[model samples]
Target: MMDPQIERKLIEIMRVIHESDKPIGARAIADELNNRGYDIGERAVRYHLRILDERGFTSKHGYAGRTLTELGEREMNEALIADRFGFVISRIEEMAFRTSYNPETNEGVVPVNISYFDKDDLETVIEIVSYTAHEGYMISPRVRIIEEDEELFSLPPGKIGIATVCSVAFDGLLLKAGIPVEPAYGGILQIENRKPARFSDLISYSGTSIDPIQIFMSRRTTSVLDVLEKGEGKILANIRQINLSAYERAREIMEKVEKVGLAGYFPPGEVGETLLGAPIETGKFGIAIVGGINGICALEETGIKIKTNPVSTVMEYKTMTEI
Candidate 1:
């Protein structure tokens, strides 16, 4: 009702006056607030207007209603131009909100901002497994979970990693085979083959204090595709681009492996394994996608890894130059 809230009400009232094409009287404003579920009395509204006048957010026009001052106009303009998160926190009072138990989608309509996380904040590591092609055997790719203090894993340099995430609480089933399970926000997740978890070449979600080794589970193919399309912010971007090139190279290299039937980094009994009869050609992607806007990011000795990030959505800003 009428408490310190009056000042807040005053700010709102001043803003309404500032934006209106027509001047509004005190009684009309009070009526509007009440209609909008605020229970302020007319007298209280009048008191607020006077305070607003002192603050220069509003001014009196002789016998007419108040109007916003230059300061008020500037503040209003700033509010209009604020970011989505900032606007919700600063201006919005209430909103619709909901959550689900599934992975691919979840949205909260309530007012809040996306927290900027640091490395020290994340202690638990979640990762997905990659199909490692051992020299002697052609085995299907499986998950390899490496926990804290665990011995580091050694794999061939050519494995690729990827992941998908669920917005809701997921059952732990999606995690890699040996990896220790971290406390998830939701429950254990069910990982159908459609939503297979893979290794990520990006590393945006990797926190600073994290173990050098990590992996994560991704959602379905569609979700993974979306994640890949958007790209991880840091290391992943480089890796994804490089991966395209690497795939082309791999096809070339694999073909040579077929032609010469060479083994190891070398070829043809006592000679090099490469089709060109040389060492494997290595291309470099500077960094892995590290997380920022969306998804998780992490880094490894070789390159970076990314989950999902906001890059897929292209937001074209209307530059001042346009007008």
Candidate 2:
């Protein structure tokens, strides 16, 4: 592994070069570092820049300065990942302390609650919580195993439960629960309203039009899902319209919801290809759930219901179950 201080300086130097429009010299880099309160000297910066060049992270121009190579951009991305991991660790420590009592004083008490889950379940919770925090959501999750309880003799031996003290927003919870569902049903809402183009103009508009799943894509980030389009022109038009309409409609919807102060509900299958302006034959434009079973449960808890038929015919199962 590289020395931590050297790695940090290399990352900082790459950041300076990346942010600049043109190649920069060591002196300029040192100045930028100083501005950021790093107190780095020009000589030190030059030495690190040389190391970076040798490592293929940066390349020197004849007299112009040094510029970051593709490798350098990747290194900067790694640095960001490192920073996010550090933040997650710090948050986990804070949550642990907040949930647990002081061993010596027996003070620093929290609400009395109990949870039961197995080791696998705990791992799932941790994975979800870490992902949630990494995505810029605030989550203070507390989890503990229930080792022993005579009052719960009928329960499993190793039961664990988790609770979270978080901001009031269904977005984070939905994302977490949807993590396990396959072909997640979640998609962006495309709204079109000519009257209100911006949030400020929404006050003059009485109603809004929403088109769900105008651009349907899978929730998996591992690989890009192929875009199923009927004809080239149809797909292009759909993309262009949704891209423009979604933003305008979003502003109007938010404004209307705020003014009316009422929740809106839409049943499953209510939104179809006709509403989204896409042909059903394309097989690209239908509402489908992602994240597997856990995702379906999460959606149900949020007051949206779904129906599914088994893809396999070998086994008999319930045709429909309300989430």
Query: Clash number for model 2?
Result: 19
Off by over 4 Å in 2: 84-323
Number of backbone-clashing residue pairs for each candidate, in the order shown = 59, 19
Best by lDDT: 2
In candidate 2, position 76 carries an lDDT of 80
lDDT of 2 by residue, 1-323 (tens): 88887887787789778855567888878876764446789999989988998989998987668889998888787764544334322322233233322223323322212223354555554554333322212112232223435432122345433332221111211222221111212233222231101111110001111111111211221110111111111000111111221333433432342232111212112222432322232222222111112222222233332221111001001111111
Model 2 superposed RMSD (Cα)? 22.8
TM-score of 1: 0.26
Model 1 alpha-carbon drift over 4 Å, by segment: 1-4, 76-323
Candidate 2 minimal-lDDT segment of 10 residues: 196-205
Highest-scoring model, TM-score: 2
What tens-digit string does per-residue lDDT give for candidate 1 at 1-323? Answer: 34645545665676557534456678767765653346787898888888777767777876657778889777654542322223221111111111111112222111111112223322322221121111111111111222233222111123222222211111111111111112101111111332212223322221212111122323211122233334321111111112223333433432443232111121111111221111212332211111121223222211233322211111111110110
